[model samples]
Every structure is written in structure tokens, then in C-alpha cells.
Target: MSYDNNSAATPGYFNANRTATVTVNEHNFNAAEVNAQITAALQGSGVAAPGLGGWSTNGDVHTASVTFSADADYTFDVDYTDLAGNAAADYTQDKFTVDKTDPEVEFFDIEDKSANNGTVAPGVKYSDVNYMESGVDITIKGAKHDKTELSGNRTNIANGESIKMEDFKHDEETDDVYTMTAVIKDKAGNETEKEVMFSVNRFGSNYIFSETTEKFLDDVYANKPKDLVVTEVNVDSLVFNGISYGLDGTKKELKAGSDYTVKQSGGEGSWKEYTYTIKKENFEKEGRYSVTIDSEDKATNKMNNKVKECNIDFVIDKTPPTVVITGIEESSYRADEREMTINLSDNTAVKCVDVIIDGKSVATYAQKEIEKAGGKISYMIEGASEPQKIEAAALDMAGNETTSEMHKVLVTSSVWIQYINNTPLLIGSILGIVLVAGGLIWFFVIRKKKEESK
Candidate 1:
């Protein structure tokens, strides 16, 4: 019963027992950005805390997320405490990898043009489109065009680092500019597409050549011997891939064997250029003419783009030139002295004019021969005159010649005609002069008589 008070505190020397201890936040996990998952291993230790964005964790477990700060590796830090702020560590530095950019597909070479991109097999309408990368395919489609362009997702292109896509049509349909789109894809289902348009230029660049027209006259004279070829044929009726290309003023250069089927009959493909021949429209001389040159071919596009005609138009002038003489008439006598005016002109140009008097080139008429052939000729009477005949001979650049169309003028000198026109005026002037002299003399005589009477 004694020792009831013996339950006192244990004395100094023998008291030793652990009350508190230190621990760390430990967590570990791996992740990828593709799964859209945020990973955490905070259970049994650290509190799951959010990392660099797009990551969130409750006090217990981590949640999954499609959102992330960026497509790059990331780390999630988990912190822990034993009871208070005693111990802590980055529980998990989980690594996450991401890839976001689309793969690039290269097609044409920047250098070494003319190298085959691929379509170089016989009867193939296309050429090469070489590539320098892996995991890419080209599928061409002209959804807006005919079936020939609808290449349903072509994947059979020969595979290589230098992959080639052959057999792309080289010729454009008549009057139509076509578009071809290539859809490129890779192993991961990534895709890209590019479209190219081929313009219709089948008849060639040098299509039409002609002359100047001045409203009233189409100067076929400008083309001279060669002539202009003009005719209408429907160039748009060309059919390719079972579709007709309607006319729209398109001139495509011949792709020859690339566009049309080759045949052995009638001159090795009917696209022979019309051989130009020089012909004169001279039998009838002066007239308007529309000359033509045509070659037939069911296969090739015509020279001027139409299937019906390739022609030329020109005119040849062979009309005789005329000379005009103005001054005197046949057997006329004129009191006045004047020169005869001559004018010679032609459609081309006047070459020379000749003056023949009594069938001889007279020196008295300095214009016995004029290169321009017509201007004016002076006449002078030096002796008792006899009737003289005058005529003009004119020639033109086209070698056509004609004398003055009017009857020749016969000129003669006349003294009687000169007197009647001048003699009466001369006699009146002498009588006026004598009357004035008589009045002055009479005035002087009267002055002397007045002085004598004074």
C-alpha cells in the first residue's frame, strides 16, 4: 500500500526514446505529349503539384490533359513534408516528348533544269518530278476537268530518296488552261498539296502576220510578194480525253509526238508547214485579191489555229500612170506669155517626163526632160512664128507609161492680138502730154503783155 507517491518523473540518467523524424517527397513517372497525358507519382508521399503549365494535380493523383505549354520535353515537380516543412524533393522529373510541325515535301530542283522529273517512258505524256526526301507521295487531280486528270490518290510512284513521279501530261488541251494538284503524304498521315496550271499555247507563238489597213484600203501592197494568210477555222473544236476544248484564241506550240499519235502515211505526221510560193496576180492587172495557202491535217492544230484555213491576201497594181498638161488648147493664139504646167502622178511614183517638139529634144525648152517629169515649161518667141506642137511623155515606177491623155496644144505668136490689147492706151497718153505744154506757154505770154501796157 505504500509507494503510492512513487509514480514520480523518471530521473535524469536513463530516458531515451524517438518522437519526430525527417522524410522526403519521392515520386517518378514517364510520359509523352502525344497521349495528351500529365503524369504524377505523388501517392504515399509528396503532394502532386502542377508543373510548367497544362498540368494540374489534386492533393492525391494527377489528371490527364491534351493542353500543354508547348511541344517540348517537360518536368513535373512533386513536393512533400514529414509533418511540417521538414523534408522535400522533386518527386518526379517526368520526361515528356512532343512533335508538332508538319513534314515538308520538296518537288522541283532549283538547279539542273531539264532533268527528267519522271514521266519519260514511251507513250507517256509526262516527265519526271524527282524528290530528295523520304515518306512522300504525289496524287494529281483536276476535279474541275475531265477524267484524264482524276488520278485517284496515286501511291505507286517509284520510291527512293530521289523518288520520281512520272507520266504527268505535257500538252495542254486546246483553248483550255488546266490545273493539276499534287497531294503529298507521309508515314504519320501528315499531308500537303500543291497545284500547277498549264496554259493552252498549242498553235505556237508566231501565229498571225498581216499588213496595215487604212479603213478604205487594206494595204496588201505592204506584204508585197509574200501576202497575208487569213481564214476562219474552229480551233477550239480540238478534243482531248474525250472532251472538246472550245475556241478561245489559244495558240499552242505543237508538242508533236508528245500530243498527237504518230503515223507513217502521207508525209510522216500531217503537220507539214504550208510551203509559201510567190505568185503574181498580173494577168488582169488592177484588182483586189485575197490569196491563200492551206494544208490539211486531222491530227495537228492548224498554222493559224483553225482546222479549215491558212491563207494570205495581197494585191498587184499594173495600171498605166497618166500625165496632166494645163496651159493652152489645140490651135490657140494667146497675146499673153505663160508657161505650160505639167503634173504627172501615179499610184506608185512617177519616174520621168519627156518633152518632144517636132520629134526632137529642143534645148530652148530647158525642161526637155525632167526626172520628176512634170512641172512647168517656159516658151519665148524669137522670130516670125510658125505653129509648134507640145506633148508630155510620163512613166511610173511600176514600169507603166502613158502620154498626156488630152490632144496636144499647138502654140503660135500673134502681133495683131498684142496691138488691139495695147495700142489705144498708148495714143491717149501722148495727147495729154501736148495739152499741158501748150497751157504753160500761153500763161508766160500774157504776163509779158501786161508789163508793156503798164
Candidate 2:
């Protein structure tokens, strides 16, 4: 059976098999000592020498080429030797194999922003993203960014993957300068921070403006400019009851029983003037009249009108004189006296003093008698037959009259008669008896002597 398949055997069974080549590429060495150690390891591992079917090198580098059985696992040990061909001390031979695979990153993400330490506007917030081995966790920090820190714990922050800055409130107490910061960490334990500055200011509303002064109002109302010009309607003064009226230029006076118009002197076309009338009865009754000038200028239409007030004083002597008795002397006197003197005075100047006896007027006395006697007037009472009543009436410059009370007086022919009449009856009877007795004795004696002689 074995010889029967000789002619059917696979073609080219006698052809030689291709050999498996083991080529070593150059190794990356960071230090020349490390490269020398690697070259010694290859040489001491029983590998063929360089350029002798095992490895080759230009100068300091060495390469190896070899063939191995297919589908067979092989293990070998690398022994490092020193430059003297002896075992090297403090040298490590690390085994490595090439599988052509990608390496894995333990943690990967962008680092979150860190807490900023600069100015920031109020009522604003900041945030950042972070990564970790497990997952992303956010951390937050908040504060009044526009205010100064009072305590050491003013900053509120957390340590995590991601971070978010809380919003800050802006109030009237907030300062103009502000700062905000953000801190963030990544999966690799890396941290970053950022800061920003901003400005805060207060706003205001709008309004209108106005202007006015008190001096302007006073000047407009006082009419200080119209003090000069004279008008045709002006008069020198007002007269009444024999008295002339003149003002101190502070007020205007009008004639009695006359009506007049007062203005600023231009005319009716100018500012309107005040109009008033002087009634004769008022002047006659009160002896004086007063009026005020309160006028207006209708040219400029205004809510508040211009006005002026002054006292207008007028003189009128319509009042009658008032008489008063200032002095009087004699209350009683003898009627036989040559003159009766009286002292008198009046409120006004005395014009005359009249002697009135028993309701009858005596014309013998003159005003000259009262004036020359210094207000004492004497009247002849010698011719009066009996005790009579005498009085005096005074007339003043204004024709006012005042009368004195009647005075009592006695009139007698002789002093002896008066003495006898007023004497008691006992005194008169003694004198009468003596005179009768004497007359009777003389008559009787004469008769007796004649008879005896016959």
C-alpha cells in the first residue's frame, strides 16, 4: 500500500523548505551605559556574534538575525556581562515582547478652571468642567464678589472633578470694585484657577429744573418806578372847613365834594388807575377822609395781581369849637359896689364876655374890658336898687358859648341905715326911748316957767 502512491505524491516533494529569519531591529536607549548593557546581554545569551548569522552593528549598536521553528514557543535568559567578560553587578535584565497593541490612559479630561482672584461684576456666576477616574463631579464656590472679606472663611469652595461658581447678589452696599475666581480639578489630580475683574455703579433718574426769587415779586408789586411824573388832574391840596390839606407825598388827597381819577400818568391806555369819590357829607361829618391806592396792571396776565396800599389823609375843620370855663372868682358881693369883677377863660380864644343880670343883657361892658383886665370884666352894680343876681357868658373864636351860674349880691343906700336895719331890736329900742324922753321934758319945763311969772 505504501509503494502504490509513489507516482501520485505531491509535486515538488523533493524541493528544499524556506528557513524562518529572526531579525532584530535597533533598540531605543536613552543612555550609552544602557546600550552597552543590552549588547552584553545579547552576547552572553549564546546568540551568534555580530555579522556571524546572529547580529550586526555599525559601531556602538548591535543587531541580531535568527530563525525559529514555526508554531513553537521558545524561552531564553539574558545574562549581562561587564567589559571584562564577568557578570555585571547592579544591572537588571528586563524581559519584553512585541504584540503591536495600543496602551490605555488611566484618566483623561480637560482640567477645570481654578478659583480666580481678580475683579468681577456683582450678580454674576462662573463655572468649569472637570474629569475623574470614577466620573465628573462639580464643585461650587460663592461670595459677594464686590465686597471685602471680613473673615478668613469668606471663600466657599469644594474639591471635586467639576466646579461651578455661585451667583453673587448686588445691593446698595456693594463696592465698585469686584473680583471672582473659579477652581477646578481633573481626573489626573491636576488643578487650574482663573480670575476676572468687573465694575459696579449706581444709576439715577431724571427730573426738570425751575428758577424764581422773592425780590422780583416785591419789585413788581411796589410800583417804585412811577413816583415822578405829574398829571393835569393833580391839585395843590384839598380844602375843607377853612383848612388846607397837604400830604407828606405818601398818600393822595382829593378835593371835597369832588370825584377824581388816579393813574400812573400815561392814560387809560396804560395801566388802569384806581377811581374814588369824596362825598361832602363824609368830609363834613368826619372832618377828614382817607383812601388807599390799590390798583393793578392788566397788561401782563398773571394769577397774582400787583397791588399797593397807602393812607390818604385830608383835613377839614367842619367841627365846631368846644368852649370850657377855665376860671371864676366871686360867689357873692354887695350890690352897691362900683364894679363886679369876673375871671373867665374858654377852650378857644375868648371873643367876648357878656354881663347878664336877672335874665337881662347889660350893654355897658365891652370885650376890651375883658381883654384889658386879663380875662377879668367889671360891670357897674352901683345903680342896682336891691340884691340882684349877676352872671357872665363867654363867647369863643368859633362862636361857642358858655354861661356862668348867677351870683348873689346885696344893694344898700348908706352904711348907717344898713347897720340899723341889720341890728337887733334891743339896740334900736334903747336909742328910741332916750330921744322921746328928752323931747317931752323940754316942752313941759317951758309951760311951767311962764305960768309962775304971771
Candidate 3:
């Protein structure tokens, strides 16, 4: 009879179980002669129970067991005799592995430093430890045996693994503490996982507004100044540097435009005019909100730090002031040197009244001066051509300004000349003509009578 070894007992991989099992398929089978001579051995590892078996068979079916003493590969073979008194000459051989445990992986401890000052976190007295921006260590204790392999994310593990990394800065890029995972695997493909955690702090802390920043925000009255100049904090100098704030701070390694983007205009200088804008929708019911800076997310982003924050409280005003020019008739004539009265009416207190003649500010009454005059200011017009263009701008306390449409005044050279030129000459001139005609008739009649009498 022949033994048919159909499948492998230890299929793909296994730990050091020290035993391999296989089913004995009998042909022309062995029922009574199974124990005739069953032998097994591990190749290069010497004999592992050379002849040990209590044959148990059921018509063309039997069992074979192989024992492994050490971690080694072996071509195990088994031989037996059939019930027909035939000795199987060749050995039924296959591969068997002996490993049953994972390798031991150990990791040492490491600390995260404050990015602001290049100091360790949980500092003495818990001072201003703002951000964490350094590499995390995953120092592995060197392995002892040749069967163990240690590795990190790359997984290029080697014997006696020891790796040090210094690129540990996690902020908006990920939402968890920095961790380095290293796994150690045995020759039989069993693994042991170990991780080291780090606490990376924020790079910069919130600081009280500086004088430059405060004035900039304070001057912002929603709609006060047209094309108002805005000032943006210098990230490189103050915010990210932690120079202005009372916090431990350090320079960032990530480059701007590549690693992160700040919602700003202009450059990295301190207090410069920027093009940052406040949307009209934000002022729907204004309560100290006009503008903001944000580092928006994207489908592909590389920001490794939290978006820097600024806490600013600014009030807004968006309505224009009311402007009216009164006490001046439209398209009317004046000799010269006329006092034109301008009136300002607004919900907010009137700031000023600026009388513009032909688009030039001929006279401007300031806030206190205009308020003292009950929001009415008079401006003198002289040496002005006929239909002189006149406009008035009223400013409210909130910096809202409204300039009225131009009104024309026909300033004449002389009012008396115009009056005489427009009036019909003497109604008494007709009386003069009638009286002269009567006198002439009377004289002619008298002269004619004298001539007739002569």
C-alpha cells in the first residue's frame, strides 16, 4: 500500500506550535500492517521521534503526526507497510514550520516641546506653553533575536531596529495627538505593536490687542471712511513669533503658501494696509462684527498647525448721514457775498457739514462746531460765476458721510442792473409824450392865429 499525503497541515504560516498534523490516505490499503514501520524526521534538524506511532486506521485512511523541537524548517517524511506485505520504498515528504509566539517589541518614552519657546511641555509652574512643533521620537529597544524585525510607518524593518524622527507637528492636518507606531514581527509572521504618544502644543497664544491693532479696529466704523486703510498683524513678526503675546513661542518650520495659507492681504510686515474685507451679510444685525481672518480648508491642504486666532471686538456703522442745503433758492440770482445755510439731519449725531463749491471744499464745519451751531452751518459765496455749483456733505459721529447733489446759484454782477434791465421803462414816459403833444398843439394854434391876424 502507498500513503497519499493530499494537503499540508501547516498551510501558509504559523507560530511555534512544535507540531504538524497530516492525514494518511491509504491505497490498496493498510488495515492491520499500519504499524509495520512508520518513521518521521526533520531535515537538517536530525530525527524528531524517528519511529513512534500507534497505528489507527479505517479502510484506506490513517493519521500521521510530526513533532518539532526547535524553530527550524524541515522536510518531514513518513514511511509504512501495507496489509498486502508490500514495503513503501519512497518517503512521503512535505515542509513543516515550528514557531508559536510573536517577537517582543519595546519602545522608550519621549516628550513634546512647546513650539513657542523651544521648551518642553508641562513646564515648571505651567507657564505659557503655547504650541508643539517638533519631531516625535519612537526609540525602539534593540531586538535580541534574529527572528525579530522592527519598523515604523515605512515598515522597512531590520534586525535590532533603532529609529529617531524629528518631524512631529500636528495641527489642522490631523485631529489627534502625535504618535509613532512601531511593529515587530517574528520569522513565523507574528507581530507585536507598540506606540509612543506626544502632546504638541499650539504655536501661538491669544494676546491682548496692541496699540496698532486696537487703533485699526477702533477706527473701523463699518462705513465711516470710504476705501478705509486696514492694518493686518504681521504673522512672521508678532503672531507666529509670540513676540507681542506673553507666551513661549518659536519660529515655524513650515513655509507659507506651501504648508499653510492665512486669510490676509499685503505682506508679512507689521501694521500695513490690507485688502481684507467684511461681507455685508455679517452686518445684518451688527453687534461688534465686521471682519475676520480664517485659514479655510480644501480638498488638498498641507497645514500642520492650528489656524491662528484673534479676538477683536469692533462695532460697526453702515448708514450714511443726511445732508440738505437750505435757505438758498434754486436757480436764483444773488449779487455776491451770500451766506448759504446748510443743515445736517441724521440718526447719529452730525459730525460735520462740508460746503463744496464746484467740487471743492470751500468751507467745512467740524463736529463740535456744527453741533454747537445746531447742525446748521453757513458758508459765504463770492466771486462765483452765475449758476455756481454748490454741494453740502453731512458727516455723522459714526463716520458716515452724505454729500448732497449740486445746486446752482445764478450770481449776478449787480442786482440793480438786472432789475432795471427786466422792467419796462417809465409808465410816466407816455404821460410825458401826451403833455408835450398838447403843448405843441397849443403853441401851433397860437402861432397860426397870429399869422392870420397879420
Candidate 4:
């Protein structure tokens, strides 16, 4: 019942008493034949029982036994064979077993999803795994299904750190609207994706008011009033005076005092009335006055706030005309010629242009007629040979006079000469007379000689 400690065992055997036995009944084989067959099977097969001391066969049975000091697991193998001399089937099993365990993962804290403000500042991180211990590789990917991947594989995310998505390349064939995505990968090759939406706004600069004012001013100046003296007063008022003739024969009625209103012709074939007030103090001192006319088309009722400027210079004349000697030509001429020319002009339109010879107004020249006659006039006098001083004066429309310097001219006789001597004519006449005289003298001489001779 006891066995030595150092012993081997057969395959598929347990050491209950430090021994194992296999019995074959007579139906399978006789005891002696079975014992012989078992011995042969054990010898040929490599199977052994570690629990038995060794393999043995006796009386139609096979036994194996093994002994150990303490309870310890061992390994055993068994083989079986058929009597046809084929190799036996072997079984093998190990005494020790092990349990497969998975590695621990240190998960980081979950980060707030960064607002995809289209900028990379606040970033996001996954809290499910640590990069160092997790058997899976770490990869940050963009959820932008267009295969956009983030640069630098990062697992740790800080607060307010941005997750940058790949630059979007516009596809000509697709719509411009694009969705941004971010993907995070853990060591286990797991990935998470997030997306956000945004749009672009565009703008530039424009001028609203000042440009309009400039355009209005340009239009007003382009159609300026010609005959009227247009002067720009302050922002509110306009003053004008007629350079030629006023609406009435008298002075033109202007918006003289402040808070005065008047009607004017609009640029676009319409009459427009504008309220204007002139500062009398400014007008009296000969300062410029201006008025603003907000004109509206009578038909279309389109109001145009046009600014018209005017200046009026008024002067009162009570003094008689003062004569200033400008220039005078000679007055005394030959008896046949009876007129002398004088040059005269005045500051204002001349009313009368006259020549005075020795303070006698013999001929008066009309200003318009004189101007029509090349801006000068000649005074005709009888017996122009007599020496006299002549002066010319011009009277303006306002009775202002300007005179010319007196010029004294003395009349003298003109000498005359006539030449009658010519070479051919004189020679011919002299020759004819001499020839006639010679003939006559010859005839007389012949008669006298004939008488003497007789």
C-alpha cells in the first residue's frame, strides 16, 4: 500500500495507493493474453503515468504507480494500440493552468467639447484611456468625413485649447457649405468624432453724405447765373443784383433784410420759392450775401435743395461828374479839313462823348454812335486854320464825367511844286522852232539879196 517517493507513473493513472491498475475482462482477451498484450502496448507507445512508480502488467491487468512527499500536480500521457501493429494513440495534458488577464487602463477626465469657433484655441480630450498604459495606439482624427486628419497624435487635452481641423479645400463640384469635424483615437484604435457649423461674413467701406453734397455743389456751379451778381451768403441766405437792367427800371428788389423770402427760377424749367433772410448789417457794409433755394419740380415735386450765392455792390451818387483828362489829339487843322479825332472812355457806360474847342460845344457826339464809330469821334470846325485848344469829355450814365488833356494845334500852309522839263519833248520843240526860224530867215535873206543884185 506504500510506495517510494522517487517513482514514475503511467499515463491516465491516479495514485490512490501510489499505484494504478487497468483490468481487461475475458470477453476482450484472456488474462494471460491480455497481460502479454498490455506489456507490448506499454513498451511500444511513448505514454507514461507519472503517478505510478512505473508501468507494469500482470494477470490480464496494467498498473502504474507514483509516490510524492506532498500533494503536487503532475503531467501524464496515455497511448493505446490495436492488435494490427499500428502505432497507438497518445494523450497528453499539463498539470498547471493559467488565467488570461487584461491590462489596466488609466482613463483621463472628460473634456468639454470645444466650441468650433473656426479657430484653434480651446481643445478637447478623451477621458477613456491613458496613452502610456493602453495597448492601443493614440491618434487624433477629424470627423470631417473627407478624410481630414489632425496633425500630431495627442491624447491629453487642456482647457481652452483649440482643436484645429484641416483646411477645407473647396470642391468645385460640391456645395460650398462645409461641416467641421474632430476625431480622437485611443490606444485601442478607437476613435470619436465631433462637428460644428459656421459661416463667413464679408464687408467693405462706402461714403454716404459728403459725396452727395459735393455732387450737388458741382451741379449748381455748372448752371450758374450769368447777368446777375450771384453771391453766396451764409448757409441760409442769397443776394443778387442785376448787372444790366433789373426786372423793373429801378434797382432790382433783393431779399434785403433777414427773414425775407423770394421766388427764383429753378434750373429745370420751374419756378421755386425759397425762404431767405439777409443780414442788413452785412449787406450795408458791401459784404457778400448768399441764399439757399430748396427747389422742387412743380410737375414731379422733386425737391432739390440748391444753394445760390450773390453779391451786390450799391453806391449812391450825388456829386456832379468830375472830369479827368485822359488823352486828346490835335484840334486845329487845314482850312479844307474841318475835323479832329479824340480818344475818350469812362469807368461806366458813357452817356455823352463831346469835344470842346475853345470852350464851344459846336458838335455833340452820341455815346452809342461814337462807340459804334470805332470808339472815337472827330469834331468838325469851320476855318480850322485858326489855332485853338481842344478838350474832350465823357459823361457816364450816372452823370459822372471824365475829361481828356487839352491839345493845341496850329494850322500852316502847305507848299506846292510842279516839274515840266523832260529831255525828249524839250529837245523836239526847240529843234522845230529853230528849223522854222532858219527857213524864214533864209527866205528873207534871199529876197533882199535878189533886190540888191537887181
Candidate 5:
């Protein structure tokens, strides 16, 4: 006779309802005397004999079994004897344990985190999403078990090594938040899992804010200071936007000290501010310019200023507008008011136009008026006997001014001179009549004297 039950328990582990049994296979005459002794015991509850009712027979086989019903470590033993009084080796099993418990896991306290502007939820560290851009250092701790596994956005994370903030950055288009799960398991197949969530901020458009109104500024004017600022915190390295192309088709980046200058404050874990002033030499000529500032946060995250707000685009209009005075002749005499048209043009839009006579501004037209009139302004200069130095001036948004060539006009504004110049046909006809009248009188006198003498 031998133990016949096949227990599914692991070598030294057990679950509910496991059984142990014994079987006898003999065709002897005295089968009624065949019997087996069985002893089963739970760890804390001393040993006891199982209720193994006399064996049941089927053909030449007899079998008996006992089932375990409680949760605990158990030990079992069995001794078998044949019908003819032949003894068999005893079978014994030890330390089959039943367990139903879970493990615990957690992350270590994160340090070296930047200042956060956002509020934190309970049990969540590094509260602000922007803080990740500057990068934080973290690791795992407080996990006790046979084996630990990690899953989610990040897995197979080194147990004690520093984890960079970039590791937690997920695809912003799909999900801006990142979650990681840590699972800890015990040798008895019991396990527990905990989740850690992180927020991330990726590259996007930036904005230029107005200090006075705290609103966005769409245009940059030359009258304003050439200051560029950033809102990101904890900036480490900065790269200004300026380039020069070589004859060999290669380009070189502009230098900070030579090409531009920078002033920075409040960073390395706090709100950061940067002011870049482009040198005047770079804008010696007048035109529109595009500039960019590319940089990296403390975590080595790239912050490119290629987007609208972050990029710099403005007119560097150092060149003045052109001015022309029409409908007036230089040094011409006029006894009546002469209407002159002032034409203005510039690379950019003209800001204003001024009509000046002698040394004072006679009239001024604003940008709107100039634009409404299509960059032309009509004005009449009062007639005067004395010559007048007239000039038309144009200005652009950059405060650049241009004055037209001085025109000395209305040199002789006398009414008689003006009449003589305009009524030439009438004067000629009157002079012809006087000459004919005098010649006719002289000829008649000559004829009368000749006839009398004859």
C-alpha cells in the first residue's frame, strides 16, 4: 500500500482543500484485516488521527483519503500493512504552509525639486507641472518583498538610482500626465501595487506680455526697450538667435558678448527672468528682423523659441522715409496762395508728415491722416512778397526723419508784377495803340507844314 493522493501544493506551500490518501492493491484471502495508520497535524493544534473510515474495495484495490480544511502549516504521516501481515515503508510530508497576505511598496522622498507655482494634492510630490521642465531628481524606496516590478509610462526603473524628470515626460499630444506603477510580491505569491503620477509641460507657443496692462503685446515698436523675457523657471543654458552664413555654405552662430548681451535673475528652482538686448550694430540698416532664443532647462529639456510669442519679429527701421513737395516751383513768384501736395514713402509705413515754412512747423499730419490720404497731404502756402523757405518732412515709426530740399518760393509777390506776368496780351495791345496814335499825329503835322510851305 502507498499514498495515492496528488496534492497540487508547491513544495512547501499549500492552499484550501488539499487531500492526502493511501491505496492497497492485493488479491489475498484475508482483505478484511488490511489496514493503514494515518496521522495529520496542524502547526499550532497538536497531532490527531484523521477519520479514515475502513478502506473501500474495488476489484483488487482498497483506498482511503483525508482532506485539509483550515489555513495553517500542516504535517502528515501514513503507515501501511498488507493482509498477510507484511509491513510497508511509512510516508511522511512536512511544512505545507497556507498564506493570504499582500506586500507594500512606495517611492522615496524626492529632493532637489524646483519651486512650484501650482498647488499639490495629498500624497503627490512636485506639485506643479512646470517644475518638471527644470528637472527634479528622484528614486524608489520603502519597498519590502521577494521581488519588485515596475510598470506604466516607465518601467524597469533602477531601484536606487536617481531618476531624471525627463524620464517622466510623456507625449503631450496624447497625455500630459505620466503614471508609474510599482508591484511588490512575497514568496507566497501575495503581492501589492502602488501608483505614482507626474505632470509634464512640453514645448508650445509663448507670449509677450505688457508690463503696464499685463496683457499680450502683438507688435514691438522701436520706441520701446529691446528687452526679451521668458516665463520658464530654472533655466541653465541659453542660446541667442543670430547667424552668419559663410562662403562655403556653412553658418556660424552669433556670440553672446559680441553679438548681444543678457541679464538674468531668479532661477535655479524659482521663476526665471532673462533680458536680451540686441546690439545696435546688428541693426545698422533698416528692415524687419526675426530673432529666436533657444535654451535648455536644468533637466536638459529643450526650450525653443521658434513659436510665435517666443520668437522675435519686428521692424528695425533706422532709415527715414522719403518726402517730395509737388505743385510748387523753386524761386517762382506768386501773388496768390499756392496749393502744394506733400508725398511721403518709406520702407515701412510712414508715421507722420510735416509741412514747414521758414523755420517753424506750419502743419502736421498724423499716421492715420497720412494713411487715409494715401501718404499725400494737400496744403496752401500764403503768398508773400518776401521769399519763403519751404520744406516737407516725413518720419517713420522708428523716429527717423527726412526733410525735402529747401525751396525758395514766392520771391516777388507784388500784385503789379503778378498782373504783368499774367496779362501779357493786354499790355502788348495797349502799348501798340499808344505807338500808333503818336506816329499818326507826327505824320499829320509833317504833312500840314509841307502843304503850308508849298
Candidate 6:
């Protein structure tokens, strides 16, 4: 009889329980006769009893199998008799090693070696820490025993080898949270895995506006002063530095929820959003103002007044422009070139000035004309036989308007009428003197001529 072993070979490591089988092929004997004659036993370093399953035969072939569970070196021995009833040669299998123990692994610490300042403490399940910049090395220290191979997501390591936390680094402008997993495996196919996580603060925090300062200044009807309304901000760090609001060149302190209100959303490795609204109470009246905002994230990325967008310079002018009528009296007939001046004043800037005469706009002076004229509109009242109603209207930059009260005056077209209108008091005095002289001459000369005739 001959035997074949179908199982682990000698000097091989197997962790799982496997059945070792031996097959005997003999044509002279049937399955039942061969089964009765063949016998098997197990011998090993940890085996106390030689336990083996009963032999079974199929046709002329007979097989016997044995299973092992414990970690030990083992060998199998089979004894069988030929069909002729003579004793057959014995079969011996080499040693089979079974290993069921897993290697041991331990992680001591994980640290960041970046330029920024931060702290990492042990926590449950992915706790994030701050000031970890991108492209900086990280160090991981650990211990491993009886390990055949080791590997990592970021770097490969030897079995149970301690890696320098400074060796693993990420260099990218985009911000992200990084996780490194170390896997250890033993010769018996046993594995252990451990992971470390940290956030990379590559992009710094910055302030943005819902409305541009220029656009806010343009849409002045919104009434309040046009200042920074921090929004669309992108903060990638887990730690947050608070926000501060102040007026430029002033000692005024702005209070949150009173002077301004803020709304924030999102978390680490995401686009953080902040909406800052300057409350109406902050601007009690209309005027020009400068607002300054400052803020930072956990990574010490700053957005402050130093940033041009964070420093807001704008004007608030809800009041209308003022128009003053000069060089003219309430009621008078003065017709001369450049006889009246319409002056405009505003808290902000004068956009345009209009001169209305007799309920109709006679002249319009735009920004260029107003600027050239030093914010004044000069006009001559045309000579007319009747009284004329004149008014001056002004518009400011903030879409506010003002119209002056009607100015009623009479003007003469002729030179004599102009002279008469200009010297009204002097002419009145001369007429009074001529009238008295005529009255006296009429009374005295007529009486003397009457007496002479009598």
C-alpha cells in the first residue's frame, strides 16, 4: 500500500484549523476491507493523545483525516495491511506547524512638527486640534512585537518600528484633514491596525463682504452707513479666533449683537461661513464713517484691518442737499448779468443743481458743472414786464433732493425802466421836492398875478 498526505507541508505556518488527510490506493481490496485494515495516529509537540478519525474507503481507494486546533508542531502515522493479509509498510508525514497567536502592537504618541503653535491631546474618536499648517512633518512613535511586516497609509514602516513623527508631512495649498493608518501583520497571517488624525490648516482665514464697499456706497438709500458686512468667509481650521469690530481712527468700541451681529456655520476641512451685519443702532445719524474688522482662525490665519477689504471707508448721507439763493432781495426789480447765485451744500457730495423759473427748469448743472462752479449755480434774471417766480433745486450723492422756496421779483426790460427800478428811492425823493416847489409856485404866483389884474 502507498499513501499521499494532502495538508500543510513541514516548516509552514498555519493559523486556521485544517484537516490533514492520507489516501491509500489498492486495487486488490474493496473499500470496506481496506477501511477495516488501515489505521492512523497523530503525534506532535503539544498533542497528548493521538486522535484521528476512522478510515473510510471508496471503491479501491481508502482515506483517513485528522484535524488540529492548538499551536504546535505535528506529524501523522498511518499503518495498514495489504489485501493478501501481509503487513504493509508504515506511512509517516513530516511536522506541520500551527500558529494561532496574533502579534502585539502599541502606539505611544502622534505629534505635529510645524512652525505654527498648537497642542494635541488624546481624545475619543477623531478630535481635531489647531495651528497645524500644511506641508509640515509629523512623528509617530509606537512598539510592535512578533510582527513579520508593517505598512502605513502615508509611509511604509518595518514590523513594530518606531517612526519619526517629523518624517510624514503634507505639502499642499488646499486645506484638509489627514489620517494615517499603520497596519501590522505576523507570519501566521494575524494583523493589527492603528490610526492617527490631524487637520492641515493650509489656507488662512479671510474676511469677505456680502456687498462691496463701492456698491454699498452707491446704493445709499439703504439708509445706514455703508460698512463692512463680513460674509462669504472661508475658515478651514477647527479652532476659531473671535471677531472684532472697530471704527478706524477712533476709540469707539463696538459691541456684538448690539453694534453688530454675527452668524457662523460649517466645521473643520470645510468652507466656514460668517455673516456680520452692522446694526442700525451703530449709525445714529448720517455722515461719513470708517469701519475696521479683524479676525483669525485656530491656525492663526488672520483677517484684519490690514486687509484692504476688511477696512471699510464709506459715506452715509440720508439728508438732502441744501440750496441757498443769494445776491437777490425778497421783492426787487434788478435785471443785470449774473444777478443771482444759487449755492448748494450737502453733508456728502452734491450731484447736480437745477434752476427753475416760472415753474419750469431753465438750467441744469450736472456734477462736472457743479464741481467747476464750486458747487454753485450762477444765473441772470431775464428782464420781464411782470413778476417772475424763481427756485433752485439741489441733489446730493445719496439720492436726496432739496428745492429752495420760491423767490418773487419784478424785472424791467428797458434801460430806463432798469435805471428807474435800480434808483427807486432817489427818484422818489427828487419827485417829492419837485412837487412841493410846483405847489408853492402855483399858490404864490397865481395869487400875485390875480392881484395885479385886479
Top candidate (lDDT): 6
Instruction: Report the Cα lDDT for candidate 6.
Output: 0.56
- After TM-score superposition, the amount by which residue 311's alpha carbon in candidate 1 deviates from its true location, in angstroms, is 9.5
Clashing pairs in 6: 135-170, 138-165, 138-166, 139-164, 139-165, 139-166, 140-165
TM-score of each: 0.26, 0.25, 0.31, 0.24, 0.40, 0.45
What TM value does model 4 have? 0.24
lDDT of each: 0.36, 0.34, 0.46, 0.36, 0.53, 0.56
Best TM-score among the predictions, by candidate number: 6
Off by over 4 Å in 6: 1-203, 211-215, 220-229, 238-248, 305-311, 331-338, 415-454
Q: What tens digits encode model 3's per-residue C-alpha lDDT throughout 164-276?
A: 34333445222222344555454455555666443332332222234555575666444532222223322232222111111112222333334323344333222211233
- Per-residue CA lDDT of model 4 for 1-454, tens digit only, reads 2223212222322223232244322223322322211111121243333333444556555555433222223333444443543433333433311111122222222222211112232223333321222323323333223533434324443211223333333331221123344444333233445544322101100111233333433333211121222221111112322112122134333443332423343232111223333322322321122333332222332222231112222332223333333333443233444455665554334567777879877567776786786556656544443466767777755445667777776443331100112335567878999999999999999999999998
Question: Candidate 6 on 366-442: residue-level lDDT in tens?
Answer: 98888888877788888776567889988877778899978887776465655555567768868999999999999
Q: Model 6 residue 377 lDDT?
A: 75
5 against 6, candidate with superior TM-score: 6
Range of the 10 consecutive residues with the lowest summed lDDT in candidate 4: 199-208
Candidate 1, 90-143: lDDT as tens digits: 343434322233334444421111212224221111212222234334443332
TM-score of 6: 0.45
Each candidate's clash count: 22, 22, 15, 48, 0, 7
Q: After superposition, how far is residue 402 of candidate 2 from its true place, in Å?
A: 1.8
Q: What value does the lDDT take at residue 27 in candidate 2?
A: 43
In order, what is each prediction's RMSD in angstroms? 24.9, 44.8, 20.4, 37.0, 22.8, 20.1
